[model samples]
Target chain A: MTPKVFYISDGTAITAEIFGHAVLSQFPIEFEALTIPFIDAIEKAEKVKQQINDCFITTQVRPIVFHSIVNAEIRDIIFASEALDYDFLNTFVSPLEQQLGVKAQPVINRTHGKAKESYENRIDAINYTLDNDDGQTMKNMDKADIILLGVSRCGKTPSSLYLSMQFGIKAANYPFTEDDMDNLKLPSELKKNKSKLFGLTIDPQRLHEIRQSRLENSRYSSLRQCRIEVKEVEMLFKKEKIPFVNATNHSVEEIAAKILDKTGLKRHMF
Target chain B: MTPKVFYISDGTAITAEIFGHAVLSQFPIEFEALTIPFIDAIEKAEKVKQQINDCFITTQVRPIVFHSIVNAEIRDIIFASEALDYDFLNTFVSPLEQQLGVKAQPVINRTHGKAKESYENRIDAINYTLDNDDGQTMKNMDKADIILLGVSRCGKTPSSLYLSMQFGIKAANYPFTEDDMDNLKLPSELKKNKSKLFGLTIDPQRLHEIRQSRLENSRYSSLRQCRIEVKEVEMLFKKEKIPFVNATNHSVEEIAAKILDKTGLKRHMF
Candidate 1:
């Protein structure tokens, strides 16, 4: 039986799904998530109990996620965390409450967690954008104001997916395949759309770390191969006039900002 | 001199990009969004001041988002409408927040009057999933253990995208094209993948309101077409024994829950 997680949010299922998916990703264990939204205090607690029972009935020991922007009283009813009463939305929402059709309340007890969100969900967008895609996305290359090109471990997929999912901008990235690297030129299709092109490069060491799990210890997965690929791709980006960024030692946040800054194209895509 | 919106998030530029793009879609209004991340007391204010000098900053009308865990004195120095002195992470993050490392703060003084975010942003994943996508994303199907099929405005897109984006599931949705509708059969792709199929349908009147903006007063845009398309497609779903839900007034929360209830397909990609 899979573990059970529940998302209890006020407004939409997206909030729950957003939290649910993220929590599940951090652990290797199998889990099942159920979302209960537009739920109030009474229903939220009841659902948690019910879901827990349901999971126990099925999976025996239910591992779970309860994600929400809920209130103190409600949080206490469901989870035993001391930070349940602590919340963050009160200040920003004061003005928009009337328009959003919700009331406001003040509750304090929680402090800022040591770190901020890493947006691991965007990785979902990345995988989907790469795996679920066909020729149609690549067809609109000219309309894309920014295009990312790089090898598999260069971080092109995550960056491009973030741009499209977050900004609504039609962004597309093409891989710098071995064929392109050997030929020492961008794909003819990408070369034609060179004005919007950008590239990403990473330290060969880090590149190997990212690829090792998937490829195993083959020659193609060697440090020497990574180094060679990095250099070839760098040369290719330069020859094609594609500005490139080195992602070693930089956090994803820092890397994305540098990329946004270098593109000089407006970064305003919702 | 585009209006400059500032994002003080700590994650990727994608956070700013999404917010920026969302704000941009409401244009005749032109604005450049300047993003500053990993902000604390001093630098946060500086970014706001710099933007004020360089561009017509909207929230400088005092925009701020912080948690209660931070000092109140800092809130005075920086402009946060809905400041959280508390932590945004709750053992887990919503995919959107986890990826971006930012959370929505309340707008205190709506004096500047930014429209509330559209239903689009909150559940953007769902919409992305339902976007017919013209078969651009076929390869990622393994990630999509569940795919949604429905007519226009049936809430299929938002639900599917939400599942995919939030869960890292490769979710795909196909609009039962006119050809499929006429034949009273599931599309060949879906028919071949029957075990993974899920369906969604919505009230015709609801569908009419949703489509009104894009089609305006055209005949195809009429309530009549909406009703017919809905009725015919629903019958088609029934004929093929496709499981579906009628997405009338239910919020995204309810819709997603109902889907989970009906399909029994798990969406956590990991």
Candidate 2:
């Protein structure tokens, strides 16, 4: 049986998950992971402890817990539970306290608490992305922090959304059609905004596989079409001297970060 | 002058930023933070070192650096810079390596690498959120993990989007109008799906300010109107014994986490 992994936090459990996943990645064994966020009260912690102990009895395997509980009482209860509990925040907080010469006050979800301007900026970015998805709002190109250029399924949409959601960047994406791909020239509107354009290219084989999954036996999903489109896109990007990244192997997060890094676009709001 | 803070990473620089901001929040000093992500090569490392040095020269204050560079060469360069560099990855990697009895692989953005299914699931959730935004797709209410019920500008939309974007939760939001607010009774459509409903209430003054920023001097933006609507929504929630949150002080991330914790609805994907 795969080992049970739980991410517990007094807040979002996002940090706990991030730290837990990173640490767990060193091991090859698989795990069934669950997230328990906003365990702010001792009563909730007690319930979680019961669940952890119950898992121990059922699986005869101690559950691995990665937690960022701010309350000492709750943390102690979880620590005493029949599980391998790692207190992510406390472990790092002490070292940080020593280095910064200040005690780390345990505030639940303090990082996420009402940075009103940042939150509003991110929401505005998300709205902008939604309004600009797939060249729907080409007239608003000037509003974008970066415009992603790619063929269909080259991952413009998800990358744009990720950039918006995570970093509050107003990302607009335009898909290059067969007509644009055949010409090997940038669209007139995009050419004027060349400085803000970032290209995404994928291997023909990978594109074929991805497209085929969505539409079986279609010409657009064919290996030949995929090859032609990918080659044209890469050539256009190179000819235009536009910086680009390969989306064949990377996740949306990686793609977004690379785009931001390459373009030197400020995240707009933290 | 505000002390400079740099987040350096060979990958997304997300971990660096998250950890750095958390630690820096303890200090009252203002910082002009910059994110330098995907500095994988020696040449880039040298460039970053120069920037760090320049910051020191310009500000006459040692910059605080939070880094998660996996490349030893890149790490060494930043480490040698005149900055208080906190190596986030290596600081914890060794302890985790010892615990797991395995060497931690220094893979840049490994945590963000393709978990294809999870990626697709998140995309689907995002699409769901967009399609269901503002109660436009009421037919799909049954598919939602949580349905946020609130008066206008009470933070239903952003919270729903945040839940979907971050946790892959299918969150749909419905707005209660004057008609619904007038009666303390739940709308018949919502009554059937009461189990999925989560209410969001905002302080009337905060709501007034938010709406005023959007539309000036309108009935919707009036303090009296905001007060009445908020009061009615809270009364409705109380009468129905519906679980709700005050979105007055918390960011969208905090609100989403609290919703997830209260509902016990598992995030559709990791």
Candidate 3:
């Protein structure tokens, strides 16, 4: 039987889910996972505890519960359930408090709350990325924290959005299209902001497949065209001495992280 | 002196950062955080250990180190550091392994790696959201998982993008501009997809402030205009019997989670 797992928190439960998922992924087995977010009140915590107990009664197996609940009352309710609880928050909070000589002033929703200035800055970054996306305007390239260059659909948009949304980075992207293949070079605006330039390349076969999904049987999706565009864009990157990465095997998280790592860009955590 | 914290990981260190941030947010006092990612080798771990030791020697206070390093040898190196270690991964891994009666098969980058099909689906959702954003076209409303309606800059675009990017929900947004306020009614496409329609409202003062930053001293940024638009759109939302939330006090994470909670949308965890 697949093991059951629960990610519980008084807030959004995003942290619990991420930490639980990371730990579970290390094991070579699947888990039937459920997330219970916003368990702020005692009643809600009781109901969740009842649900966990019911699952154990039916399955004859103790469920693995991972929670980051800040409220002591609500957390105690979960801890009393018929499951092996991994209290992610309190496990470290006491030790941290001891080390720092400060008591934790636990507040619900603080983990994901909008810290006013940083929140507004994040919104600004998102709007900046959208306005500057897809070479829409080279006028604002100078303001961009990073500029991603690639052929069409080489994961530029998602990577750019991820950077802005997750890390509060003002990311602008430019596409080196099939038309630019003949004499592919940086635009004057991009050359002026050359220090912010980063290239993303994909395997030609993968690029062809991605294009085919959007515009099937078109010259844009053809294998020959994909090969040519990738070659020319990669050549331009090499000649210009721009750092690049292959996006074919990496997810948006990996791609964004790699870019930040290579560029030494500071990731502003929310 | 602020307590120094380090989030160290072999891969992106995103999980480490998130978990550490969540844990640290419980405290009232501020902390200085530094993230070091891609620490896969013993040599890299040793260097990080040296850095942590240097921090301790300089401040006469041990830094708090939170790491999710999977490799035992590399992990041991960090464990030898002078910092107060919080081994997020291994803390629960041993108990989980015993509970499951299986050894963990630790692989680097699995948490955020491209698990091909889901990664593709995420990209598709992002594209769908972008194509259908801001009522760009009513044609694709039938295909969206959620449709957000609000006045201009009431947090529609960012919320919609967050829904798609973080949760893989195809969220399309429509703005009720000043023109729409005169006859605030849902479009036919939106009326037909009423079940998916979610409304966002904001406080007039906040709306005015947000708009004033974009267009200074214009009628569009006037407090009166902000109040009128919000009133009309909210009235329309009530008349149409659409579910809604106030976006003034919430972050994108909170808004997205609230939407999912109300809509019963399954969060497609990447």
Candidate 4:
């Protein structure tokens, strides 16, 4: 088997899948994709070195590595990792050329960009669905590119999947746990990915009303808990530099658009 | 466990999921959903009956059953199976409605009202994407209400998912197997559902060319074998009274639209 390219990025996996899928889609080469998210360049350096060595022993061709992420810590990690293994590697030049030059392949990249975002959004939605549907396979939705920080029963999963299905965005979401309210801090990862972070909050009374249907007791499903999560989470977002949207009584389209607008990401025309 | 209300159907699991999901999405219910597809309605009738009997032994609320399927044979099997043991069964009003009505809470039937033709187109599209997308899971593309169909690698899944991502339709597809070719007939069930049937055929040379990329030297990848399958299978469609579309050198959109036009089904308006 030919040694497949290793695309290591601190960016969300959806982004990696988009660009990786793009290259694979065009070229006829065996590919094995591995993703490590939330790694600042600094955090990625050591792991990147190990991945390169693993690629060499496992396959026949030189490894192709692509890294596209915004975290400076991860950027620093890539720089150090690259310095450590300078041989047996080649960089993708087109992305740089496109960034610097005008005549880049627009259509393909546009699809990749769209797919990347969509994949992220799907992940977020899947996580939300898992949380709500079966409460199994639940991951920490906090580290998501877009932590759908909303009430217990809002249409987080559908909204997330809608975002992914429509735009291919890597979206993750965390229902505000009671701990978040008492301690009053977004998860630590959300704090780290603060600029790229987004919050989804819904009305407290509505939250209580929605929850009332599920739990046997209306006490825990009271307006008090709903009010508390919404108020505390919003305050936490303010303190942690996270942007958020009020999702109470909003359709999935409206809520998703609000996040895109606040973040200034042009809704990819689907 | 509360005696759950299950809406089981014939055809693909995606259809079952859509129906199950849409039902849950609209109302507040304390029932767990277990919907399986690609199995005939008899399997569903039996399983739900067993489940309902189990609940009868434990719970006070009777199981509310909702089922939708096109094949009259399957309906006979379900009615016969359920009539013996199950007392609380409310049948779907239209198999087409269960499959089509997007927003309303469907209580009695699943009918798309020419929606099967629409779904058939979507299915054709899904089959195309399935044969093509490397490892990408286009599972959510069930919303594609139409699918294009033909031989192996005839742009079915891609077109279906494209229709879905492009235009929120639930699409699915089945292939013309060697058996279907030699026998020159759609499955008996598909024959009665002929109004819902749309066929896809392509130039042998074009199909052979597409296969060459995946399996280089097999006779299946040869234009001769391609021609044999295309000719023989198409003849069967003609003899069995089914409609088909020729697919050669056309974009997926064009082919899907052609199928839509020929089937006389209204295109999904986004």
Candidate 5:
């Protein structure tokens, strides 16, 4: 039987989930997972404890609970349950407090809350990314912290959004379509902001498969077309001395990280 | 002086950052953090170790290092540094291995790397959300996992994008504009998909401030107009018996989590 794992927290539980998921993924076997967030009240904690106990009764095994609960009262209730608890927050907090010689303030929602200025910057980055997406307008290119240049299906949009969302960076992406394949050169707007340019390329076969799914049997989705477009775009990137990464084997997370790493971009953590 | 901290990983280090940030946020003081990702090589690890040692020598304070490095050799190199290391991954892995009666098969990039099916689902959801954003067309409302209803600039777009980007939920948002305030009613498509409808309401004053920043002194950004639109849309929500939440003081993460909790939408972890 697959083991049962629960990620519980008083806040969004996103941190708990990420922490547990990372640890669990190292194991070879699969485990069933559930997330229960916003467990601020004693009543809610009791109910969750019951759910864990009931799962233990049914499965004949103790469920694994990973929690970052801040409230001592509610956390104690969870500790008293039949589940094997991994107290993520308190585990690190005690040691840190000792090292720093200061007691932890332990405010709920501090990790993901809107810290006024950073929150505004993040929202602005999102809006900026949206407005400048898909070569929509070059008028605002000068305002962008980074401009992504890539073919339509080579993973530009998702990477741009991830950069802006994960880090408070103003990202704008522009596509290099088939129309620009013949005499591919940087537009005047993109040339002026050449230092901000980052390129993404994909394996032609992968590009063909992606485009075929979107537009089957069309010339745009043809293998020949994909190969030609990728070649031209890559040559342009080389000629312009622009840094680029292959998106075929990497996720958006990896791509975004690689871009920031190559460019030495400061990641503004929220 | 602000204590220096590092989030290091062999992969994207996103998990390390999230774990470190969550733990550090519990403290009342600010930290100076630097993230070094893709640290897969021994030379890279040695250089990072040197940097940590250099910082200790300069400040006479050991920097706090949080690493999720999978490779034992590379991890040990960092372990030899003068910094106070918080090894996030291995801390729980040993206990988990004993509990599960299985050895961990540690693979790099497992946490955020593209797991084929989940990655495809996420990308598809992102495309669906973008194509259907702002009620561009209600034709696809039938296909959405959730439909967000709110006035313009009341946090619809960012919330919808977050739901799709983070949780892989196809979130479609529709705006109730100034014109809709005179006779606010659900579109036929929304009425048919009422079960998937979720509402977001913001404080009129906050709404006024958000809109004013976008379009200065316009009737649309007027405080009275903001009040009228919010009141009418909220009434529509009540009359339709649609569930709603106040986005006034909440971040997008909070709003998204609340929506998932209220709707019981299964969060597809990427």
Candidate 6:
């Protein structure tokens, strides 16, 4: 069954969605989620309440609301809505106030505010990923926190960008061309940075499917080529004593987490 | 005062960190956080317990633990640790199980699993952003979900990438160069798709600081140039009837959300 889930927040509502998804994933039910952002005023809150009530009346089911709304006046209107509300900010703030002996400061979207250093770091990391993508420029290799090495379509690009976007990691990804895989040797430019290299391997069949989707019926997407490339790349990683992960069944988030977990690389922002 | 925060998870610990940051932002207390990931095994759980105990001993106060660990045994161990734990997964899972009339699946790191279609969409969006960045490929303008327009360093690149990375929205960003700002006309390439255009403006002083960090003491980084470019871009946006947002003090997440809200663009996922 598809349950209606509303993620309401004074700002982005990303945090509510993250926690909501984590909790809701335990159940086998599917969710149709909606985000209501920038609801800092009472009028917006009243509109949201009307929407929630209308959804319940139309569907004959109370929608689930996951919110991080911090304004007490606005939050009161949402709390009065017809939904199973889970507002983490309000639920936890009061106890924290008593424990810390200080009143909670209800700033609208303060988490992403004033943290300019980390904000700039994330932006710089993304720019770095864009610039160093596919080994386009080796000039800034030294600036990379981690270098992802893999054959084409082995999930390097997405994983590299995910690392940068989520953790402020300067990730530079280089594709292992057919020539390098045939040589069974790390490229000279990457040889000096062996310690920074992390490899990614994938199932040949899966690789073929991904490649075929991009380049229909080409030799590059052929099963035989995929098998050979996967074998050689795995061999190369093993021969070079570089740690690697199989990305056939893993999401980009999972692959990135594994890389960071294994590498223990210090992030630009922690 | 600085209180220690621990984001522990059986997987990436990212969800814990995201929610932890959101909830903790309500309080004025400062936090020093450490992420302990991959604690699915009993031994790893024991190690985490010891670390938590050691941290408590060292700090003379209990740490605030935000976790998403699913394994019951491992969670039991963490629960036994000397910390004020907030395991939202378990806290909300039982109620969901009861409501759904099914036992909750206690899989480790399952939120990002088996969602291959959304994963592929995100990757494709990132690739699209890279290809169309800075008006590099106007050939594929029709495929863009949203086109970002702004003066240089108005945060088009990072905002575009964030939209792609998080929501799988194909975003193409173009910079308003000095010549284009002078003309105050939309580029011919973008004229046909004015409806998809969203503009970004920034504070001149902040823009000066950001540009000076990269290209120091240049006309591009000059305060006067920044002011003129911002004024021209705002005028252009108004004249064209294109929606815009000031990105001077906002984070990439905030800017992306505002864009999505303003555009009413349907995400490739959700």
Shift of residue B229 alpha carbon in model 1, Å: 4.7
lDDT (tens digit, per residue) of candidate 5 on A147-221: 999998899988989998889899999999999998999999999999999999999999999999999999999
Give the TM-score of candidate 3 (chain A): 0.98
TM-score of chain B of each: 0.53, 0.94, 0.97, 0.45, 0.98, 0.95
Lowest lDDT block of 10, candidate 1 chain B: B107-116
- lDDT for each residue of candidate 4 in A1-270, tens digit (9 for 90 to 100): 543445454433233433333323322233454544435445356677667656655653445554544344555556554222211011222222332232223121121222334433433433343333212233553444454565566555545544544444546655666765667665565566566666777778767766775674666687777787778877877877677777665544445555654675433322
lDDT of 3 by residue, A1-270 (tens): 998899999888878888898889999888998888889899999999999999999999999999999889999999999999999999999998898889899987788747987798789999999999999899999899999999999999999999999989999999998788877889999999999999999999999999999999999999999999999999999999999999998889889989988999987654
C-alpha lDDT of candidate 1 relative to the true structure: 0.51
Count of backbone clashes, every candidate in sequence: 56, 0, 0, 71, 0, 0
Q: Write the per-residue lDDT of candidate 3 for residues B1-270, one digit (tens) a residue.
A: 988899999988888888888889888988898989899888899999999999999999999999899888999999999999999999989999999998999998888736888888799899999999999899999999999999999999999999888878899999889988777798899989999999999999999999999999999999999999999998998998999999998889888888887788887753
Q: Give the Cα-based TM-score of candidate 3 against the true structure.
A: 0.98
- Model 5 chain A lowest lDDT segment of ten: A112-121
Which candidate comes out best when scored by DockQ? 5
Alpha-carbon local distance difference test for all models: 0.51, 0.82, 0.91, 0.48, 0.92, 0.85
- The regions of model 5 sitting more than 4 angstroms off are none
Residue A118 lDDT (model 2) = 81
Regions of candidate 4 where Cα sits further than 4 Å from its true position: A1-242, A247-257, A266-270, B1-193, B199-260, B266-270
- Against the true two-chain complex, what DockQ does each candidate achieve? 0.14, 0.46, 0.76, 0.01, 0.78, 0.66
Query: Which stretches of candidate 6 lie above 4 Å from their native place?
Result: A98-102, B99-102
Which ten-residue region of model 6 chain B has the weakest summed lDDT?
Answer: B105-114
Positional deviation of A94 in candidate 4, in angstroms? 37
Model no. 5, DockQ: 0.78
Candidate 1 C-alpha error for residue A65, in Å: 9.5
- Candidate with more favorable, higher lDDT: 5 or 6: 5
lDDT of 2 by residue, A124-164 (tens): 88878878989886898988889999999888887898888
Q: Which candidate model has the greater DockQ, 3 or 4? A: 3
Give the candidates in order of TM-score, highest first: 5, 3, 6, 2, 1, 4
